[model samples]
Target chain A: MGIIVLKGYMIFTIVLMIVYAVRHLLFAYNRAFGKQKLYYNDIYSSRMPKISVLVPMHNEEQVLHYVLDSLLQCDYDRDRLEIIPINDNSTDRTRELLDEYHAKYEFIRPLHRDCPDRGKPAGLNDAMAVATGDIIIVFDADYRPATDMLKQLAIAFADPSVGAVMGRVIPYNANRNMLTRLINLERSGGYQVDQQARYNMGLIPQYGGTVGGFRKDLLLKMGGFNPAVLAEDTELTFRLFTNGWKVIYANSAECYEETPETWEVRGRQIRRWSRGHNNVMFRYFLRVLVTKHMNWKEKLDGILLLLVYAVPFLLAVGQLDAIALFFLHEMDILSGWWVLLFIGAYCSFGNFAPFYEIGSALTMDGIKNEVYLLPLIMYNFYFYMWTISLGFLDAIADLITGRQVVWAKTKRFTK
Target chain B: MASDHKRQIYFARTYRHLKANRAECALFLLLFILPCLVLLLLFYDELTWVMTNGAVWMIQQAGGPRAEISAGTFLPRLGPAYYAVLPTTQPDYSLILGNLAVCLGTVWVLSTGPRKGRPVAVYLSIMLLIHTMACAFFLLGKDLMPYTLEDFSDLYIKQQIGIWITFLVLIGLVMGVLGRGAILRRMLTVVSIMLYSFVLGFVRYVLFLWILYRFSVLYMPLMFFALGPFFDFLYFVAIYAISTNGVIRIYNTKKKGDWVWA
Candidate 1:
């Protein structure tokens, strides 16, 4: 009777798993259905939407030029666009470059900060006080979008329900070394397929901190941001979703960013992100799921994403249980070929699905770009520490202890 | 002025107290080092078994690259098998002591077992996911067995069909409950279905599967939360399922979708 119940439960679980996997596959199909890109020139009409592009910087002298050059070459509506480069407490040539660009580019406007540290959100809020545009686009110093990004983003907003749109961020110098190669693979699974999958299915996804756009009205409605947390982007996203607003994502709106050259730098950036994410989760955990007007599904998704940091530890435990069972139950588990097949089936499904989806989403022609470390991508087991531990621990501390977190900057690099 | 000098004298007393604490800082090594040594000894044979095969045995036995550590906590290579791959890298009492000291210090910082700082935790968790993914990406996505890149397009399609069903159920339930106001209720049904579909798609598809996998639905819920951080795809499905009103039919249901090439 005991064996029968166990096996019966296994059958039930397997059936449920398949049913669930099928559901997600179908959602992705609809998102991809009949969606094709419009070429830059053909889609980019001369009637440019006046965009207020904000670059809030603390000490971003390194990559300001790269961003400026990319902005100058935008595919649509550049004439009506006003570039406000907000220099937040930078005692460097960052200001000089901003001035040089302002001198050369008529659309460039520079603002300097003269206050004690308030952080990135405060910098953005200050800039928003003076911004003038129908559309607001935010970019980090390290990223440079494709020429057609503005045009593509504008077109995506044609749908009235879309409150914001997120663009794709690809590693600009992916081939830098082994570390970057692993990073490229991880990023692909993260932003490309994961974000796109959510958008296609109509779930509210956290915006990419860089490469996102907002309506001026909605921006004001959200009141800039709650500077109390490290990650303001995540906070604003949930707030916007509960208000019956939708965010759109365009995979073709390509932008490139520099991966931290080494793990040490990556570690610092992740620590700040972890702290910020923890703050966001605490502030919004139950609020987004149960109390918010959104259904159980979206809230569950939000909670799960915040809690997803805990999955690795759980899987490690599961692996132990499996190993224990091998010793305690199956002396030689190879006794059944069926077991091997079952393991193969789920393992294959778990591992491979994201790569193809992300790879295809990134390329215009749908050809996969081979980041050579593809084989060693698995070695990153040592690479993603901060995101899980710091993100999870910090989140928990903030929630339990009610300790507030402040924004920490990701030191930018230029090529 | 008298208080300032008195305060300086108080500070001088505290500096000695801190120096005394600093002398005991090296003792922190015992916490992590002791466990590592005990674990090393406990799994000695397994370590030997791995070492005999030159750690190839460890890689194979753990079932792949991601299993270097037994249950992902104690990196077993640091165990008895430490000498097999790099025999010259002898395990010294001091080195073991050092490893333990660093582990203890970090774990102390990490709190219970080095609180696994966010950097170490996220990076390690992501690495494990990538490792699992490297093992499966090709086999599932492109339909290439034993490779990277999988096509989860099916997962998305079926999610849509599930959404459609959920909305039908939700609308029927609401109509049955509030039949008096026909126009207002009808408007709500349409709006609710549209809004709820996203949440429904996410719940049914993503979170459900996550629960199934985490608890091993077959066994117990031992420490599955570790996989929680790496379960990005699972989270995506939950959001997709919950927010969707209906699920799309990726396959005709009449045929085996897995066998068909996209």
Candidate 2:
């Protein structure tokens, strides 16, 4: 019975890996060869919606000025734009810096939060209460948006059905080190291929926490951002999709953000992401299944995306199961052609982003030499597996104990 | 901020199909398919013989007296193939207990260490887990061990063949489908990967045999699973990435206007 169970699990893991491999391959192929479903890039209106750009800062004194100055330089109409840098219990010079900016430009509003109720979601909730804009855009304190970023993100709201818009993130410090270079490859593959392909297929395109915006009224109507939820962005995505709204991906709405320059920082960042994403997964997995707003394809892709954080944990367990089978010497669970299938699936499973997907993305992005860093991403497979699995366990513990999730920010490396 | 304008080209450009490159596509197909056919039909015997002889020679040099090359038929239809046969070392009771204690001690230390959540800790924990399992198997299920040294060698040779064949086909498919380069560049990429795999596989085969001959069969599972074809894919990806980078550089330099805009 034990052998049977192990063999069955091994087969199941292989199948899941194959599904993801095929999904990635299809996305890559579509991005490379298929006709792209265009974003609302050309849609211009004389009367654009009032916009509030929220920059959430917590002890982000090191890099607060970059985002504020960038926001000041944006070409959005001054009468229609408001820059609110939410100072969420920051200790350093962040509050003072924001005050300086606010004094210089009345449009730059600094909301200082010294209360115990902190974090991005809570800060966003408080900021949204006072923001007069119809559409609210969010960026991390480390991000530097282009002059037209506000216009690019806000244009998607012109479509009544688009509840949220996610922009592409390009790493500014990609040339820093090996870790940063690998992360740049991951970001490129993720946005250039994965998000765009999903949008092209009319499937679910995720609204990442930063470099994105949503309708303030719609979020307020659904009860402002849940302070208890760590991943307010993913939660908002599912809430909008399940409520007959859409989240569009604007590939052209590109923004520059800093990626973690070290493995330890990257590990913590991914772990927190996994924890928050898994929490959202647990909250919305069932809702996604029965939601009438989404079609069959949307539901399938939604479930797969929700389960993305959980896969590394599952694969870790699958590795242990393979070891058990090896020890038991019952390795011939599937013979003949199944062996070949198993090998193919295992190859795909070894790397989270398969070679072809990353290759296709680099080819399309016109990136010249960074393609050489693709192999270094293999080390990230194990790194992410362990960190993500630990985060999965943390999420499980959170559910069992009903503990409050504390949001941990990724440490800024920009000096 | 000036780089922002240059960055816009990444998304602003359009893509059209490489319709004029049909001849290159045909060449890619031939490059991918022909090598596998030739390796299987013409060079199978010579390849297996080289692997077997190399392993046997390495084992003898590493102080294993009884190592020899042998032949076996994995599939009756494929005829006999060469494999290395080495005497298997059995662990004594004291050695098993000592190793088991050491594994447990290290795992306990790792679990309680300050760097508990770090990657090094995780890797060590995993390695200790495998070693512990091996110690337990030798201690508790010595007679139940399924594979002999000869059996392992045969399986290794068979799997190595499978890996080479798969690498050829997979690299071809990846280059053919996603690779953007002249046909010669793409073919060179495939050849580079194949050559690297052969060298890596040969070195690993000899190293595994040397370790097995010195150590007991307890480490067989580790060698087979942990240090097996899984690590081979690492260098395979590295070579492929280097080759792809070269292709991208050439395209950007010489064929800048050939970009298919979407």
Candidate 3:
């Protein structure tokens, strides 16, 4: 009976892994080989939309100035643009710095949330309430947007179908350490290839809260942002899609942001993301399937995207099953003719997170040298299995017990 | 109006292509359907034996026919014939049900495809038939064949390593074919194909799991989720690609576009 149950779970894990792997592979393929290049054009006319840039900061005194300064240098029309900086209960000099910026720049309007329930989603919700622009753009405290980035993002709105537009995020201090380097590869694959391919395939291109813009009214209609969820970006992506709106991946609208400088910081960030994303998955998995607006392809992609955080947990379970099977002397079940199938599934399992996806992204970005570091992802996979599995447990506990989780922030480093 | 007209023309062209491929689709579907049906029949007896015996094996592993491991933890135990092709005991109706569902669900999905897609579905049935035969051959080839876990593991590892080497060689050949032609483009294509192939392989594993669960009811729930998708993947790799490329080629020809055959 225990064996039967375990076998069932193993099958469940392998199937999900296959779906996840296939989705990423399809996206990568469409981005690489699909003739119709989505977001490949830089043909934005002089007709720019009214843009409201929301910079969400929480005790971000270390890096607020850099982002604000970058925004100040943006090439968009000054009269048409408005910058709202959300100062969410910052005890440090963050509010004071925002005040300084507000005084100095005519466009910088700082919102101070002195009350409780302070996180990025909450900040975004408050900022969205008063955002006067036609298009609402978001930037994290550490992001340094290129002058033309706003224009590139705004241009996508020219097509009425585009509910949101996301730009590529390049890590500024990527060369600082090995952790940052690995993060850079991940970010590159995620944005340059994965997101791009999804866009090309007419599938879900994630609106990664930072360096992404969306229709203010659409978000407002979707009941603003869910403050309880950690990955507000992923939640918003699904919401947008299910609501008959599209999120465009503006790969050319590249912006530089700080990645975690250490493993501790990276681990915390991944955990929070996993917690938030899994929460969204529990909420949206069925909704995505039954959503009237989405086609089968979109639904498949959305569900696969929702399961992204769950893959590591599944892989970890697969590892445990392997051990259990080994001790039970049932490991031979994966031998002989089954070896090809097992190895194939195993390869697909790794591809679920790294290697070929990252390699393709790097190759597309003209940074083929980093392809050699692809093997390091084996270690990264194990790390993800550990952290993400723990996060999955926490998510499950929170979901089942109706326990509210405090939104833990990703600690920033000053470089 | 121009865009609408172009779309209409494209649809007309696509219709013609599908019309042309109907015979091929029928022929392909017919080729595999008989074998698959036979394989299904053969699977019945094997599945029954595995369920009854594998349950006993499981019971033995747990401690004995009447023994149970501590409820909280999964107590891993080795049965006497752990290396045998089929392992399990007790008749699992779920495996039989799941297989029935997969076979029917796959046929239904394939049948629902565009005119051009029906043939592709037939092609996928062929792949599934191949997978079925492989599983059947393994089970019936040598009754209750046993081996050491280490020896099996070594063989598996070596075989996988060889596959990787073969994959590298294929990529190298692709590069040679390109011969200084769009280096970045070719490299990205290779990477994408490699990743996509892994996904395809995983889908194949999913189907294998469906087949595996037939003899072992231990993981019946896994088979449930694996059902419709096994067919979906089989269809995707076998038939979907061909029909899509065919339509694209026909359209490209109509537009006098580059006849770049992939």
Candidate 4:
């Protein structure tokens, strides 16, 4: 009976590993073999879509100026562009910063919210009520987009089916610390390889909240961003996909973001992400599987992607099974032929290890020297598994107890 | 039209030359020959010992329900040792032949590629093919004792682990090959193979197999059920796809003339 339970655990672990590995492997394969439809130079020659750039902020005085300055320098038509920097009851100089920018540029429209409602989704919803542009682009205060970034993101709207467009985010202060460096690696793999691969393969390329835009009408039609969900981006992505809309990954539309510079900050950020993503997983795992519009490949990729944040928790549980087996003197079940399987599992898991993904990403970017840092990701993996596993547990508890989720802001270091 | 004909004639000549080339033929043969030698060298002593004097512990270690061994089977007198009792079960003949076909087929597919293609892809694929076959040989031989005794062993387990390790290595290599620069790609290829091989060695045979199984299962679903019940028929298909397409990517690349075929 104990042996059967061990076998069950082994089966579960094996299936999870295969699913995740197949997902990443397919991404890698598509990035190699598939034809890229979205290119930076493939600019739309049609009429430019009117874009309302929404900056949702809460006491973001330190970094707001950088984004404002960058927005002012954007190589977009002033008549068609509108910038609405929302100040969600900030006690700091955020309102002053917005007013100053508003006074200088006609496109800069400051929206100061004095109401009790806060958080990014609420701010976005408030701005959506007043935004006049055909498309709405969202950016956190820390992002410094390129001059033509808006142009690149906006052009994708020319394709009627493209309901949303996502731009790649690179970290400016990556060299500041080890935490930032690791974040940089993660971003590169996430955007350069994973997102691009999904886009190329006709799979879902996620619409990240920041540095991405969606049709204003579409969001308004769907009742704006869900304020209840911490990961409005993931929620929006699934909503759009389920409704038969496409989200494109604009890889060359690179914007700079200030990554969390400390381990504590990074941990908080990942925990928030894990919780939010798992929440979406709970909501969309079956939805993606049951959706009729998506082919088997898209459904497969989407479902695996939804459960990605939860995999670490599964791995942790499997590790427990291994330990129990060891202590229970039932390890003899792993003898002979089972031994090869154990080695294969290790290799399979190692292939999807962030080390390999980051190395591959770095190699693609022509930065060969950074590949040396790949081995360090083992530590990063363990750290994430430990923290995110806890986040997974918290998500489950929240689901069970019907607990209200809080938005934990990731503490940023401007430098 | 004349130029096309000439090109076609040139390709035919190249194909003929490739097939008859003593070096290529020898390399093809080596894929089978080397594995056999490695297996013999790895397990000849233990196998000979087991054949001459049946391991009492092996029979005892058969903790699960024991099955019958035909009196006239090939288990006891392994290759006419003429030393011990003529009793016990024999390894499944189909399992041995199937594994042999897979190893040889993998080598054949990897070795033969487009005459003109990326050198990096060819070199990397070759390394994976050779290393994988070598590991398969070692792992297969390591399980020979249990297989011969039919001692609560499953050949499907051995094959799955071997094939998955090879697939993982190939996938990593493909990622590396798609990377920028010949030097970096080559470095990554060697480094990846070495790192994976080292990890495989660190855990030894039995532990390594299970760990391999664990990771494969962790990354995928329906692995045990699909590959287990189907007896690895689909696994062979995947291996074929990975090896064939991996090499063909080099052929398909625009910058194909850079690397010489290995």
- Which tens-of-lDDT digit does each residue in A231-340 have in candidate 1? 87777777777787777676667789888766656767765676676667666777776665677667766776564444333333334333333223331222222222
lDDT of 4 by residue, B30-129 (tens): 5433454345435433443343233222332444222232222122333221112213333244544554466566556644654212222333343334
Tens-digit lDDT string for candidate 4 (A286-347): 88888887888778778877877888788767655654553343433533234345434433
> For model 3, how does the per-residue alpha-carbon lDDT over B1-262 read when each residue is reduced to its tens digit?
6655655422211001111233432443344333433443344234323433444355346443332111110112312111123333323445445554565566566556452122234435533433333233333432232322223323322232223333433333323221122334434443554455444434433333333434443222232222322222232222222322333343334533322211
In candidate 1 the C-alpha lDDT for residue A256 amounts to: 90
Q: Name the best candidate (by TM-score).
A: 2
- For candidate 4, state the interface root-mean-square deviation in angstroms to 1 decimal: 15.6
Please give the ranking of all candidate structures by DockQ, highest first, separated by commas: 2, 4, 3, 1
Q: Assess candidate 1 and give its lDDT.
A: 0.49
Give the lowest summed-lDDT range of ten residues in model 3 chain A. Answer: A334-343
- State candidate 2's TM-score: 0.90
Over A205-258, each residue of candidate 2 has an lDDT whose tens digit, in order, gives 999989999999999999988888878889999999999999999988889999
Task: Give the higher-DockQ candidate: 1 or 4.
Answer: 4
The DockQ value obtained for model 1 is 0.03
Per-model CA lDDT versus the true structure = 0.49, 0.81, 0.60, 0.60
DockQ for candidate 3, C-alpha atoms: 0.03
Q: Going through the candidates in order, state the TM-score of chain A alone for each one.
A: 0.78, 0.98, 0.94, 0.94
